[model samples]
Target: MFQHLLVPTDGSALSDAAVRTAVTLATAFKARITGLHVMPELHVFTHRIDTLEDTQERYAQLAERHAEQYLAAVARAAQEAAVVCEVISVTHDQPDEAIIRAS
Candidate 1:
């Protein structure tokens, strides 16, 4: 009876299992799934200007890449099950709060 499902993932093995389960349920209910990943906000302290910029840039790139990689699992699972899927990513200091907001 569910029209839409929200699946939060962190790229963990446990999370992967949850994604599969969610997909199964969505398939049964003919529902669409939304996959969400919350990335930690980067915190760094450096005196060198170049180092700070480099670190921030690198962290941003890595965070985006990781979010994509983590959400890809959900996308693939949904695709295999022929279930519609959407993905979202956000940077937050508190992941639990982010998830709550997303829900």
Candidate 2:
């Protein structure tokens, strides 16, 4: 009996499958779903940039956009299943850490 299910996705095919499974389980149990997408922190030091701040900003923006898109898809799936869903997007250097913290 799951009251709240935390589903982490990276927009990959495998992750999408996991989302479907989570949705099915949530729908079956009438549980609330929390969809999470962790944006990987970009390592700008590896690449030469005119300004580290600019590069970091660019990477953050890109990651945020990707996370938004991924979370939106999950939200749509949950909506279609007629399940309550919450979307969360976090940027962290380690995805696992973010997910663990969210859970």
Candidate 3:
């Protein structure tokens, strides 16, 4: 039986489907689920219209908001299934690498 499941989502339809499946499995196994959202690092180019700091700040805020929104799906599914759920978000250049690290 699985003790925990990690579900990474980007708020896409496919990812939402995966979250539902994971929640179902977790409920069946009485396992916990961790929802992970990896936000990509924002690269600021000097040629951009906005200031470098401003751009980075804006990107960070947007990324954080999106991450919360994406992870909420997993949480909601788990809640409906009466399964334990945890959510986390991190910034990384590569999502695959971030997921590996999380595991």
Candidate 4:
């Protein structure tokens, strides 16, 4: 009954199971799958001579890398099941806000 299914993942084992479930559901319904990863903002500010922008950029890079890795795995799983899948990475201070906005 779903045309487009949005699945949020945190790269955890539990989340991996959920991804598998979503992929199964999408395949059954012949629906497109959208995998999302939300990068939570770093809040622990330390005066380590590094600028805030630098810290934020580093965090963003790390988040993007992890998200890509996680989504790639999910995409591969979907592909094996012959399902269409898309991946998206988002950054926000709050997980719920990022997911809502992405949706």
Candidate 5:
């Protein structure tokens, strides 16, 4: 029996589905769930690159906002399902590393 579950979400439709499924499973199994969102690490070189429209600064801002939004959704799903959930986010260029650390 699973006592704890870790659910990582990106706020995409597919990711959302997975989060919901995790919540349902937690509710049924009477387990705890942790939601994680990893924002890409902002590299110094990334700022040097210029976009046709927005600058790297803008992109970084958007990424931060998106991370917050995605993590919020995870919390909402867990709450609606009446499942205990813990949420956290970190900046790591390699999302895999972040996930590993989170777990």
Candidate 6:
């Protein structure tokens, strides 16, 4: 009888199993699902003088793209399962912490 479900993914093949499982459960329960992709906090180590391989803007853009790609598959799975789904991406230092926050 779940009314809402939160699914976290990093776009790996392993995580796809979780997404499919969540989608199936959500569909069975007629629930809405929220898929989350947590990006790493890019600024933490970017300030190091030795790490200036690219600009902050470039790094942010690349991160955003990767996050979107990861979340997109979940959205598509939810769609196929006919479950209402919302996706969000955020940056946090620790993924476990971000998953807890999203939950």
For 1-103, candidate 5 gives per-residue lDDT tens digits of 8788898888889998999889889999999999898888655545344552365577778887998899889889889888888888788889898899888
- lDDT per residue, candidate 4, 38-57, as tens digits? 88878756777568778878
The global Cα lDDT (0 to 1) of model 5 is: 0.84
Work out the TM-score per prediction.
Answer: 0.94, 0.90, 0.94, 0.86, 0.80, 0.87
lDDT of 1 by residue, 1-103 (tens): 9999999999999999999999999999999999999999888877777798889899999999999999999999999999999999999999899999998
Model 3's C-alpha root-mean-square deviation from the true structure amounts to 1.5
Best by lDDT: 1
Q: How does candidate 1 fare on TM-score? A: 0.94
Clashing residue pairs, backbone N/CA/C < 3 A, model 6: none
Residue 19, candidate 2: how far off, in angstroms?
A: 0.6
Given candidate 3, what's the lDDT at residue 25? 89
Instruction: Give residue 55's lDDT in candidate 1 (0 to 100).
Output: 92
Candidate 6, residue 43: lDDT: 56
Instruction: Provide the lDDT at 30 for model 1.
Output: 99
Candidate 6 C-alpha lDDT tens digits along 6-71: 999999988899999999999889999999998987654555765565666688899999889989
lDDT of 2 at 88: 94
Q: Between 1 and 4, whose lDDT is larger?
A: 1
Model 4 lDDT-worst window of ten: 41-50
CA lDDT of every candidate: 0.95, 0.91, 0.91, 0.87, 0.84, 0.89
